[model samples]
Target: MTANVNIAIKHTSLLISGALLGLLHAGLANASGYPVTVQSCDRQVTFDHAPKAAVSNDVNLTEMMLALGLQDHMAGFTGVSGWKTLDPTLRNGIGELKELSPKYPSKEVLLGADADFYFAGWNYGMRVGGGVTPDTLAPLGIKVYELTESCIHIMDKPKVSMDDLYIDLLNLGRIFDKEEQAQSLVKGYQEDLTNFQANLTPLKTIPKVFVYDSGEEQPFTSGRYGMPTALIEAAGGKNIVDDVQKSWTQIGWEAVIDRAPEFIIIVNYGDVTAEQKINFLRSNPAFKNIPAVKNNHFVILEYIEATPGPRNINAIKRLAEAFRTAL
Candidate 1:
């Protein structure tokens, strides 16, 4: 070949190589920033990439993933009852995903799915002694993103609020490179809260609220730290059990009678329906003369909203409207 032609070819090859090298460096920088590490529960969780195969335990976390448009990334799921209670649009998308179990899957089942990430909370998915935990799974290449509300006991944040939902969504967005979507969703929630609070101007009195989770012998209720406490306060209702200083606790009927709450918030989930709880309250003579029972004032919320998720804002809106009307 002519010397001039050889020199031209060499110059072209060098330019192409330089361009490719620059692209590779940029990609590496992005990768390094990713699989981002955050302290979850008591340990550090690293997301190497947005999980391609993910599993969500329980309906609350499942709906959270769905709301983020991350269902396509779900490899499998469990906790079927919550799925049944989801909105029609959300329910329609579940036909394709694999259901690992009706309840918490065994450790072997979780391993078999080879999920890159597991969206679950302690007790809600895998119990502590079951041998499957974030620490145990980390070595096997599966990391866990725990539901934030479930972490109050383990983390520095000991209270629950809409902030829990905001942080969880934002973290998921960062993991998936969808920060814009996360921020947009949070903004919408903030706007809804602001608008709802503005409409509460006419509420002259704050109702005393009794949150009913379950139990015939003892009434389970939202204590100082659960989402219900935050929701009740936001709705202009003072929680009668706010002094308990725990998430959900069982209180005596006499204590409830003494409180004489004007409103009762019944949680809808598990084997017992909200109607059953209301029935129990009405049938029991101990509750017969309670102001809430006498007035038929009860706000029924799905257990899903009782936890932290996108539906929490809806819970706030519903309670606010009910309180406004009742006032």
Candidate 2:
């Protein structure tokens, strides 16, 4: 057999031995109320115990792991270059960990790392037909946990909410045996959100906000189902494309011009900088009449902040401050 096969076989053998020991110490497992199972994207995954060697994929998932201070549990990570944009505190935590790859690693690469758990979500770490799909990794004794926000696109979820972030943190806490830490984190975010909402009571005018993800031909924007909608609503503003229904979508510039947004929210990610988007809006003659472009009323939010995670509360606070000042 080849070296990879040999490694897989050896890992499989070790897993069997560990599982048998776990069964023998059933009381110990029960002591923590594990073999806890969580449902993700219409599938169920059970965790017998905290993962000893975990691999975090994507910026949101990586931040979640780091926020919970689970770097010791993580073997490595991949996907996204948010470290350059992350806050210094969080960036320091990530700086200490090994980056398995700059992008999503293939099945063989993942297997080679000997990861017992994968902190990932649909279309984030494992794509629909990607070789390292959760289903494929299950037989190899790896558990995959999907981030709750990504579930809106992958599953038949009703809509996106701030609760998604809570549940994700709570679930991660459970997996890592850090339920108390999770609760504390969720409580803190909830408190911050409550404060933000309370501060909005004095504001009478809610700006018509346009979220700019990217695209010169047609702007990619967040719809009612994305986290941005919640952020906008929480920040005392309205999303012009709130009727789109999908998480992120492409809408024609004419549609945007018709709506005539007063505030523009730029999503900072990919190759496109927030300045580039702002410049595009300023330079285009078609956007000359638009209130947001005319007044240069643009709020630049980091891509990580726009997504569902620890940074969401920060996004809300920043947007709230901006709206109050702009309006």
| Residue 235, candidate 1: C-alpha displacement in angstroms | 1.5
For model 1, name the residue pairs that clash. 35-47, 35-48
Model 1, total clashes: 2
Tell me, by lDDT, which candidate is best. 2
lDDT of 2 by residue, 1-327 (tens): 233333432332222233223322432344466777665667777787899989988777789888898988988888865333445666687876777877887777677889999878766777777688778998998888887767766666755667667777777777777776876787777776775555353455557899998999988899878889878776767789988877877889999999999999998877778899899999999999999999989999987789877899889889878877877
Q: Give the CA lDDT, 0 to 100, for residue 265 in model 1.
A: 92
Give lDDT per model, in order. 0.73, 0.76
What are the C-alpha RMSDs, in order, of all predicted structures? 16.1, 13.0
- The residue-by-residue lDDT of candidate 1 on 1-327, one tens digit each, is 233333322332222233223323333345446756554566666666788888998877887788788877888888765434544655776768878877787667777887888888865686665676787787888888887667755555555555666667766776666666766776677777766565454455657888998889887888877878777766656788888867777889899999999899998877788899898889888888899999999999988888777788789778877877775
**lDDT minimum window of 10 residues, candidate 1:** 8-17
* Residue 18 C-alpha lDDT in model 1: 34
